[model samples]
Target: MDRQKRQLQILDHVDLTLKEAEFVSVVGPSGCGKSTLLNFIAGLTPVQSGAVEVFGAPPGGTEAPLGYVFQQHALLPWRNVLQNTVISLEVKGIAKAEREQRAREMLTVMGLDGFEDHFPREISGGMRQRVSLARTLVDDPRLILMDEPFGALDAQTKLLIQEMFLKYWEENRKSVLFITHDLAEAVALADRVLVMSSRPGRILAEYEVGIPRPRTLDQVRHMPRFTELHDAIWEDLRGEALKAMQGRA
Candidate 1:
């Protein structure tokens, strides 16, 4: 509960866990504290009650690497691609040569190879997002939190980035907590999907993707199991979505 507004509870008794190399996606109606949950895991918000542990340790203050890719590109306009990618490392006091080398390698893997010197304004939105991903991943964070990182992109760019992200996850196998509202995108990208309640957010249900990985979004959406899972989750989500909308109205 907010001390300022005692009745304004954001989340209540929400429980979640992401295993090693596991990819989990969370979906719910708007204003369900989905981002609040991410903030808790990222250590940006204080845990008012209950507990949050990463690898059996409290998050935020450890040397353990943690990465976050937000909805916005959040790239520095003045900094070139390579420079932006290594900013985290620079803050960590890594040697300049080592940080640049790692950042360059990640940028290359992200398909930004020849655009190292390009500023944020010079690149497309999609390319800027790739740089953001490269920056977050360059430090090799064991846990990654992505809050609708592709939510702002066009359909084509979203699909392309999904594929790119899948490739990166397949190669590195990092534990990820992804927040997205698109049911199809959630099922396509995650090993498991979590649904939350309308307000005072809580986990409503969990669905295993069951679909094979190395999955292309187009291919997975066409599968029978994908449809089944999507429909089933929608049954639970639809009501909450309606309730949220009505509350807004």
Candidate 2:
């Protein structure tokens, strides 16, 4: 969507892009329509105004390459982890051999090396999320839309998953639009960060994370630049969050 006159019931004057292989993050207070914005881009919610295009094509159009990882691990209960990861390929009518191979590789990369036969219930929350990421990445979509995929995990688990995700991104560099409430996460994983305002959400601010390349999640946090960016982003985000909580914006 262009920056000009963009609007939706929950979003307004919004414009953004995930350049080829670039990583981006959006942060804002609750109800700022962050998730709503993602829904529009993923084509789960139609744009009531302006437009949302993926890879220069309308969301879900034939030319768009997209994948989404929702906050909840929406895994199939009856299916084993391996089966769940291969479902998308299976739907595309890929040969069983090829699909399973792709899924296994992705699962291994996501750090789900051996629990392939386990059901979702048999694994920990973080592993379940690893399976979710595995499922999404197996499709090899050019653009990934993540909606707080790590929000439910404990601190350690979240950090572990974030590290895994960053490693994957560093190597593959697929375009990503990650949504989160964690300022540290936003700054750590994205090349660019966006802050949205309260209901009737709009872009409030943008930050470019310039801590340098070959950055590690652990190392970045201790860097002076990381703290600086985090503080700066929070200064902008905090106000909107308060405004949202107070219902004054």
Candidate 3:
């Protein structure tokens, strides 16, 4: 008989709560298990030794409606823009007519209305990300887990997409757990911002973002409260970030 080996991963002392229709953001240094936290909640991986619940039940249950968007836009090359947006609904056995109408409406909101027939490769990275978002939002999951969904884009495009994302979220108000390395982005969009320690990750600190709702990127950035929250979170994160860098070094 051959012996089997198993690998173990741990997230130490992590505790979090997200309320109904709340948008929470998590920020941390690299390799701090920020993405792992999202994955665990989304039930992409099994939860071990911790009480993890979504909607009063353990994660991964069919009753818990959730959506996840990864950093990479995992669009199918073969699918056109409209086709990509409706794939999730199609999987759920939605009728073609209803799903198409939903996809079209979502694409229009995402500013991809004119490029419906274009394939993933035919669109810009920003547009592909929009389609990815459209696909995720088309199903209207009660909870959404996003892992640095805009980290790959250039600065300008990232800002544009961030504003667009906030617009949708403000309107729809889904419970979102957004994971990002960008502290400002975290503060800009979240009701509460969580900071995590280096590997063997745990929640180090959290700041309640006091900025008003219905926020615009330009307006919110200039507010004193936004600066206050961002700076406080950064102070907590800087040491852990340095530790991560030194560990890598």
Q: Which candidate model has the greater TM-score, 2 or 3?
A: 3
Q: What is the C-alpha RMSD of each candidate to the true structure, in Å?
A: 2.0, 4.4, 1.9
Per-residue alpha-carbon lDDT of candidate 2 for residues 58-110, written as tens digits (9 for 90 to 100): 87675676899999999999999999999989988999999999999998898
TM-score ranking, high to low:
3, 1, 2
User: Cα lDDT of all candidates, in order?
Assistant: 0.92, 0.90, 0.91
**Count of backbone collisions within predicted model 2:** 0
lDDT of model 1, residue 47: 83
- Per-residue lDDT of 65 in model 2: 66
lDDT of 1 by residue, 127-220 (tens): 9999999999998999999999999999999888889999889888999999999999999999999999989999999998889878887888
Candidate 2: global Cα-lDDT?
A: 0.90
lDDT accuracy of residue 104 in candidate 1? 92
Give the poorly placed runs of model 1, Cα more than 4 Å off: 1-7
- The clash numbers for all candidates, in the given order, read 0, 0, 0
Which candidate model has the greater lDDT, 1 or 2? 1
TM-score of 1: 0.95
Off by over 4 Å in 3: 1-9
- Candidate 3 lDDT tens digits, 1-249: 546745545489898989999999999899989888887887788887787999998888888889989899999999999999999899989999999999999998999878999999998999899999999999999999999999999999999999999999999999999999998899999999989999889899888887888999999999999888888888898899999999999
